[model samples]
Target: MASLTVQFTLRRYVARAYWTAVVMVSVFGTMAADVLHIGLGVPFAVSTPAFLSVPAAVFMLWYPSERTLSIHSIQTRRREAFRWAAALATFALGTAAGDLTATVG
Candidate 1:
């Protein structure tokens, strides 16, 4: 198990951020392909995770502390900011992955 105090550290945070971005990108790519092939809209596809992740991260960050997400100090504000930033970053990464996958095909 990991320590709570170190959960929001730069290293841990970066690792999580990188993974989330990868996930988003893969999901987006798959969802796009499905849409093109089936012509049916799917709910909670790549975008679904991206959308949920943002709020989920915020909740996690704020809930852990006191409505603030701070990366540097692990305070409420810093945690909140970190959460939001991570979520956005994941979305961007997902977009890139999806785009790359689509472009290649």
Candidate 2:
């Protein structure tokens, strides 16, 4: 969240702000998945598909509302929200899948 605040504050450093927010969200996403499985005993088998469905649901809602999923077309707040939701879901999905693979295979 702080990284996103910085992203808005520094317009000239767009790349740095973007990357920082990405890294921050990714770290948080991994932590969230870990907490669900390790801290809350969710089980990777469940979490992997659960997290995967989140992005799918997001896209299902996003495309109907926005008419396009291109990152290049993110000129509105609505589109930005969809993009961020997808990103966080994707990162969490990846984390859950990785844990599932490592534990099961």
Candidate 3:
């Protein structure tokens, strides 16, 4: 959060700040999915599609409000917020799917 604030404010950390946020989101997302499967004893078959619905839901809301899901159209604060939400949801989806493949035997 700090990096994202400093990033858009300082005008010099655009890519680095965004990348930092993405990496952090990805790591935490993986941990979250892992907790559902390993910690809570959920199965990948159940969690993968469940996580998939999140991003799909995000897109459903985002598209109706913004009329377009293209990154090129993200020129407003609302759009940016939606973009981040989608990113977070998709990363969580990726984590679940990756684990499904890796652990399947």
Candidate 4:
């Protein structure tokens, strides 16, 4: 049916948008973490946990408010916003953690 087709198309668009946001956030987050250390002269020891807590705090708030963190449950604009925020935080945390290990070894 035409309705089914429209729904499918919408879902595809949403998925695309989600993935694009994730990739862009990841790239920018990594750049930010790097800049904090390399450009601002912040030590890895201080920055690693600082970057990590962002995602932790996001999830803490999101989970309590939304009751779930599953991707399949992201059905509303608010949920989508939370998902993007969490994604950005995770990417930044990952970048900082990776850089910290590299610096240590």
Candidate 5:
């Protein structure tokens, strides 16, 4: 029997999709807080979770299925652009959902 070990090296650039996702989530979260405070004329006592985040997660799944979800694997500019766009869309959706919650709930 022979023993084999496989090691993976960290690439200079990782998918970084997680970073974008975090940014988007943070933006939406902040928006939700601000909207609830000012728009509702109330303190941060009650604020709903970002529903838009759902779409963001979905976008990640669909995009990668359509293409690929690797940091070093993304070899095309179009894929990169799509990634950014998905992040932006998720952020925007989160903002809208937050506002809607403030208005309705």
Candidate 6:
């Protein structure tokens, strides 16, 4: 049916958007972490924990607002927004941690 076809297309579009967001956020997060150290002269020891707190705060807000952190519960627009925020925060945290480790070694 036409409705089914439309639904399938919409789902595909959403999936593509999600993936694109992930890639873009990852790149930006890495760049941000690098900038904090290279541009501002902030050491990794300071930046790492600063970056990590972002995700922790995001989850603290998201869980209270949505009542769940499970990926399977990301069905509504609000939930999707929370998911994206959390994803971005996590990417930023991971990038900072990786950079910190590389610098320490």
Please report the candidate that would top TM-score against the real structure: 2
lDDT for 100 (candidate 3): 93
Worst 10 residues of 5 by lDDT: 1-10
Please give the lDDT score at residue 9 for candidate 2. Answer: 59
lDDT of 6 by residue, 2-104 (tens): 3223433453346655565667767777888888889999888898899889988888998999889999977776776677677767877788898889879
* Model 5 lDDT per residue over 50-105, tens place: 43455557566756576666556544555544555565455555555556566678
In candidate 4, which residue pairs clash?
none
Q: Please, what are the lDDT tens digits per residue for candidate 1 over residues 1-105?
A: 122233444444466655665555455545554453346543334544554465466566666656444345554536545654555445544554455466555
lDDT (CA) per prediction = 0.50, 0.88, 0.81, 0.77, 0.51, 0.75
lDDT by residue (tens digit), candidate 4, 1-105: 232234334544566554555567778788888899999999888889998889888988999899999989888766766877787778888888988899898
lDDT of 2 by residue, 3-102 (tens): 8667655535488788999998899889889999989999999999999999999999999999999998887767777887898899999999998999
Query: Would you estimate the TM-scores of all the predictions?
Result: 0.31, 0.91, 0.84, 0.80, 0.39, 0.81
Positional deviation of 45 in candidate 2, in angstroms?
A: 0.3
Candidate 3 colliding pairs, count: 0
Cα error, candidate 1, residue 96 (Å): 0.6
What total of clashing residue pairs does each candidate reach?
11, 0, 0, 0, 1, 0
> Is 2 or 5 the stronger prediction by TM-score?
2
- In terms of lDDT, model 6 sits at 0.75
Q: Name the regions of candidate 2 deviating beyond 4 angstroms.
A: 8-13
Residue 73's lDDT in candidate 3: 78
